[model samples]
Target: MKKQFLTLAILSTPLVANADNEAVGTPLTAPPEIAAVFAGSAGTARTAEAYDVSPAELDRAIATFTNGMPGDSAQWAVALKKSFTAFEANHPHTFGAALGAFLFNNYLVYHDLPLDDAADAGMKSVIAQYDRLVREHPEDYAAADKEKYINMIMAGSYAAMVLHGHHQDKSLAGQYAFLKSAAGSALENYFKVPVDRVVLENGQLIAR
Candidate 1:
């Protein structure tokens, strides 16, 4: 059915729901933005040519897309962990109800997806878990975090790949830069996270 869904729209995972439980620094916090990683942005995988994708080749493609190039993945994982921790620490929620509503609304994005009953049911189950957690532990999580996280997702989701002015190449880095810049500003100003774009690799903020 093609699912007609993005990750948020499916609610298969809550991006920052359990963020506080993980000691604020862990590998699970970072999954490379898939669309960003697949920046070639071509639908040309489908051609009139005889596609020789067997079960094994299909599996291999999925694995490569999921785990990425193994050695470089570790480096990105560490970067994502550090980056997310710095973001959350600088933003804390003042109202519990707002946090609950924010998470609930985020899941509702998936209702717009075109899905078969089984897929919809599965997605609903996932959302239910997040709703339960957010409702039960409002003190442990924050609305500010949810807002910032959603903003990041929305920005990335909206920023799709584009053919680079007749070059036929998609700019993966451009999408990343746009997402980072948009989310960075939103986290800093809207959500009151003290994020500086110029943070040093040592986790120290630069003097503005």
Candidate 2:
């Protein structure tokens, strides 16, 4: 009976981790230096320094998601959302790119099989939800939010694909080439800028 119960429990366990299933924990804090860089108050050198810390902070969040106690992942998600929300309030013009960078770096971290699989799955889930939202309540899907949703989906899906290539030991040049192309395409589509005018500098995409 014990063996049967154990088998049943194991079988019932989910193969993929869901961020929603996790409880919210401590809020993730964004360092002031990062905010300074986003605000254009910091120098180019400081920009590099601040961005260097950003990845580490994101990794800390990922660590909490994967290894910390139950609800830690959800906590980190909520915390990051809040942190970015506050940052966005202050740096309205640059916040979208900054958020894209956060998603890019966060998705780049390599995780074990199912969790890594979840990265792509999560993007698909976003697409499905957005589709459902638009289908069921067209009025609620405002034009501005529509663009925002599309941008987010692109950033997330691109990052997930890049991470997948990284995990497979794909060529570094190929990965970056794809990223640059994606960035250029996004700028062209959303901002109506010529792709040639877009440049990647210090990990940020800038449109001239």
Candidate 3:
């Protein structure tokens, strides 16, 4: 009877992960210089060095964002994406891409929070952040390389999402494997630049 119960428990398991836990996989915690770079973007949440924008202003912007959204998961995802796009572009860096990825995953999480194996949500979060980096930072990354990175991550995410919808995949480990390999390739291409070109001997950042 115990053996039969165990088998039933295993078979009854749902999606193994959920969207709320999905993150860009880039440590959100950043150094001050990088924080400054992040603070320069428009739609980004306040970083360590973020400018003193009033909370009232932020609340107003958020209200504007959710006011017209349709009540659906996919639509909420679209709304979040659009919200990220519309935020003030004060920050010069695309670090928020990572945060946006997290939020996007959370949006997915809201729909499938009850599922036990929503690993696709986590995978999409990482992919979203990677896409943000590739889309926003072209100078540090070659256009061809950037395109390659976006394609790889997006493809992985879509594939994972499909598997989740099918309910056939018992584990989503393969998606993460693909992301890591793709990220390594992207890193290699991104670092093919002269160190001096991206940094100054004076300890300043490289400019576009």
Best by TM-score: 1
TM-score-better candidate, 1 vs 2: 1
Query: Which lDDT tens digits does candidate 2 get at residues 1-208?
Result: 0000000000000011113311111122223532222222222211111122244554444453335434455654554444433333332222223333332233223121223443334423432332332244322222222223222322343344444444565575565455545444433442234645434334333345
Candidate 2, residue 128: CA error in Å?
A: 27
Q: Against the hidden reference, what TM-scores do the models get?
A: 0.26, 0.25, 0.23
Query: Cα deviation of 117 in candidate 1 (Å)?
Result: 2.8
lDDT of 1 at 113: 19
**Model 2, stretches more than 4 Å misplaced?**
1-158, 161-164, 171-181, 200-206
Residue 186's lDDT within candidate 3 is 28
Please state the error at residue 141 of candidate 1 in Å: 0.9
Query: What C-alpha lDDT, on a 0 to 100 scale, does residue 115 get in candidate 2?
Result: 30
Backbone Cα, N, C clashes tallied per candidate: 1, 3, 16
Ranking by TM-score: 1, 2, 3
In order, the Cα lDDT scores of the candidates are 0.29, 0.31, 0.30
Instruction: Looking at model 2, report the run of 10 residues with the lowest lDDT sum.
Output: 1-10
